[model samples]
Target: MLRQYELLERVRAYDPDADEALINRAYVFSMKAHGSQKRASGDPYYSHPIEVAGILTDLRLDDETIATAILHDTIEDTVATPEEVERLFGPNVARLVDGVTKLSKIEAQSENQRAAENLRKFLLAMSGDIRVLLVKLADRLHNMRTLHFIANAEKRRRIARETMDIYAPLAERIGMYEFMTEMQTLAFRELEPDAYQSISKRLEQLHKGGGDLIDRIGRGIRAHLEASGIEAQVQGREKHPYSIWRKMAERHVSFEQLSDVMAFRAIVGTEEDCYRTLGLIHGRWPMVPGRFKDFISTPKRNGYKSLHTSVIHDEQMRIEIQIRTGDMHAQAEHGLAAHWAYKEGKDEAARTQHPWISDLVEILDHAGSAEELLEHTRMAMYQDRIFAFTPKGELIQLPKGASPVDFAYAVHTDLGDQTVGAKVNGRVMPLRTPLDNGDQVEILVSKAQHPQPTWLNFVVTGKAKAKIRRFVKSKEREETIALGRKLFDEIVQRLPVPLGWEAIAEALRRLHLHDDDALMEAIALKRIDDVQVMEALLPGSAGKGQVKPPPQRQAISIKGLTPGVAFTLAECCHPIPGDRIVGLRREGTGIEVHAIGCDRLADGIDADWVDLAWGNESDGGTARLCIVIKNEPGSLAVITSILGNHGANIVSLDQKARDGSFHTFTLGLEVHDVPHLMRILAALRATEVVSTAERI
Candidate 1:
């Protein structure tokens, strides 16, 4: 743990105006509050907060952030209250400390839910003040560093996975490369111990074989840059293990197949020299096609800038190089923390200036669930990025594999909701087309166009996904509620007494529903059947017993006036009177009625099963038949004439494919009942032209 005076000295070295009294008070107060508590590492719990504060001091954060770090765990782990911290150190420190105290109230939830809630709390705090994120990140980093102290294997893996999924990505989002890299390394070490050990062993073997290859490459690059009068600093290293593992997984390649594992950086004095060094380096080597990117002109959303290239070096080694100015290098290394290091009010300035921070705020507004928010926020914060342009030349950055729908959403939520189509490179393209780097896109939208659920399959951006989902949920509920209302009115007519608002209120209470809409939706969805709904509305209205289905041989009433709206008859079985039926409630559309013995009903992927029965109200219904006849003249006539003799009218006829020796006909015949259709089929089967005939 950092001593009080030593911590203050570290803060004052960076910020001479830092409040030494505040730091001292926080340090002493946190130590006293923690008392004799111990960590899983068997160290004093007070030591953890002090170490977290020390980490922040290395970032050169303000004194208030350091104080917040000290008290962050005090409110959660100790008996200290937020009010006490506010009283001692003031509101800024208190607020940040409270924000970083703990993630979420994870009570009795599934593991997935708990993880989502933790991320939800973290993102909410980060949006309020970026320093909350900074402190919490430091706290998590310290916890992750000591995670091995935990005895439970599952517990350790859970913490490691959460850090890998959430914290590391978050750190990267704010331009904190050093923190992100270290967190990822620690998490990777815990999550995949075997891969970690194997990769480490391989790296060690390579290092031993190369004999200071990184230093030699760095020296060679520095020599070349200085010789060209570029005034640059060069550094080289092997790639990160996690990065290498990810590449291996993505490309399905082995370590030996990887050519650009060695990366070098050239830090130049000016922006011009950054590019000059790039040009000079390319001039001396054979450039790798499609391996160059100029982030200097189009910086990342987090404000990172650099020129990247890969080349075949004089040593005949393929290597990756990044060239940037010193200031760019600092920002790339420290990210948003660099803003606080050099200026006053930079904390708030950075929070306002960065699009990503505002996006986190925007995400909070539209998320419907914690799991959803975590998923979309991860998509927004963590991914390899691709850059594209709007029709007017405005640049848009999106995750790799993002579609035009993502581009529209990145521009504006309303634009995404109204997106109909897109034109890529001046040619009309499908909306699901994945955008390419540097592709100029034109989003074709309209006021009449609404978000479609199918877009969710293709859109990869979180903003696009959340907005589309919100719209879809709203639309489905609106339509379902309207359908429920119509069904409610129809059910009310069958009741003994007329219902009023009082009856609805009574039903809502009995069903534990919030309002009439909930009651009606439940009714439409058959969550509460007619008898249950009537009983809730008015006691004993449905009598002592619920309505039961008639015997198997008897046909009950099933009125389907609107085939596509209220329900649809399954064309495969062509159900009629005296045929048992089943109803499947499909998504988006309504239920489909299938014969009980239909082959299509055997598939397991159907929607919710609804009880269905054949109605006696119909005089007759259509039964389709598939007939294979000899390929001779008058075969079609013979089949039609036979059905006509049985008093079965041809509703429709379609010629199917013709095989070598036989032709097929799909015929829809109107019959009085199932028995009548059977009689008609018997006559058709006896014909000379009909080779095989059966009801479809």
Candidate 2:
């Protein structure tokens, strides 16, 4: 029932050459493709694509994106095919339609998993060509705007959660701040209607009183700049409700404590004018210390650059002001899209501006399966970034709080493998030091060092983790293959007659294995009995019915332990190798073991405590211990030195502080016996200012 002129208007907005003939062809094709179809709202299905196309046109997308938007749903819900689309339109238009079509089909086992996979697919498509995601986002925006039409509550929640996790983040990543705000606001409204209403009402009241004040402040600032012969446009924009909600949660403060909820933007003609405008603004108002940022000189990782400062007006009202050139404004609004010029055919230059896009596209080239490509896409796209730097001033981009090990891997796998230590801001730090913005990190590497299995715990980047996993898996495969080959050769030597491949294969099948390699590896690991392999290869072998005897059980009992209690292994002493241990009955249940004089036990023990002993047959495992001490330089180095000297491999380490000067650190280590653990504890306690050391 929609008029044809509306569709024509959208096409003509981006394409001046658009005419009635083209619009008519699209209309007839879409009408036939979506014959008698109705949406969940019971509206004619053709109306949805028209609405989606309208949204894209409003965003100033190119002609192909708009056309693709018009036909996006045809292939999924109708009889239309990609081949037919290509025949009707050109390859570019068809590709865009195909991308949008692919995004509509992922099915996961649960709502959360479905949302996650849907996001994964969206990122994959976006990485290939950003316009695909743009069109999809526009579609989602329209759907969210009309979400009330859907009837089911569970379905509504599932869709809302997906929008929150995927679409909203996608909008932010692309620098569509306006779209991001709306999507988040709508999703919040659906997911937590009560919270949304409460926050919305509060924000509405705040805006009513403060709106005119911001306008007055903007006028005053504009008058001053104009009097000084500066040419600029000043406008006041309030923070979105979702952003205010996020700020409240992050700062744990009430809405009244939130300042700078409104900001003034100054748009100028040149980059030099931006800085000059900043100087003029500061002269008019007092600038707040540590509240100024010179992003123009050093842009954000996403390529956002502006001069920002918080200043107090004559009435002592605080406001944030941002100064940037007109070009920067366009970049801020359109993000990577603003850089692409179709007329110039500068694809390479455009890709250079958005390196992450290129990196994501490159993932497709190396990806072997659809699932891997999808995974790589999600990891590359849906991440919040932190900008850190090498000591030499080279920038290294990583996910927020990425450790030095992640940094080393970002530089090169070889560097990560050889990295022995690191320094942040000229002071040595632990390998797990969470990086902050603008940090100058210097990695110390030794030729003999290699990555430990524990490095996986602190790494934040998916690329770094994937690479580490790949390297470790490769090494493990190589080792297992070599072990398998060695065991096979030894077993063949013991055979009286040469075994045929068929006999070996049959023997492997009887053992539930795939090949000789697996059977031999199982033998190497003692998972398969050695005598059984010979029995399978020979007739009437004695090993056929002979089950191996269980190993002798070490007879041991703890005196202070109660029966029928559940116990957990202590991480501090990681009871591995060989060691003497004593059990302490905890108040609740299971026994806690410690190297007899563990400081943790000593502090808790009074006259009522009794001694407990461990059974003789205990094997090596892991244990945890806590150390409290003064925070100082090289503190971690001293601890690791002691543990390393005692031949104990440190498995995990975490540290926190009650105050800046004092820290409590938890360290997990493997030890041979109770005596060795006590010796390490004594060495750690000998360090100055060490208050306590005990098994936890």
What TM-score does candidate 1 get on C-alpha atoms? Answer: 0.55
Q: Candidate 2 regions off by >4 Å? A: 1-3, 18-24, 40-42, 107-109, 340-696
Cα TM-score of candidate 2: 0.54
Q: Model 2 residue 9 lDDT?
A: 73
RMSD to the true structure for each prediction, in A, is 24.1, 25.2
lDDT of each: 0.77, 0.68
Would you estimate the TM-scores of all the predictions? 0.55, 0.54
Query: Highest TM-score: which candidate?
Result: 1
Q: After superposition, how far is residue 159 of candidate 1 from its true place, in Å?
A: 0.3
Candidate 2's C-alpha lDDT? Answer: 0.68
Q: Write the per-residue lDDT of candidate 2 for residues 1-696, one digit (tens) a residue.
A: 445687677656555664446456666778789989888889888888878877766665566766787888888888888999898877977888888877776533466345434554455554445677778888898889878889998888888888887777666665666677889989988987877787778768876866677778888888888898888899887776777788889999987888768888999888988888999989888998899999899875455678999998885767899999887887666554554323233234333433434222333223345343333434344345555556544446667779999989988888888889999877899999998755667899999886665678889778778877786665554454444454445555555567675777678767888866677556544465546676676544434343333223222243222222223345444443344555454332334555554566665463123233454544445557889877888777887888888898888889855667778988777776667788988998998856789876
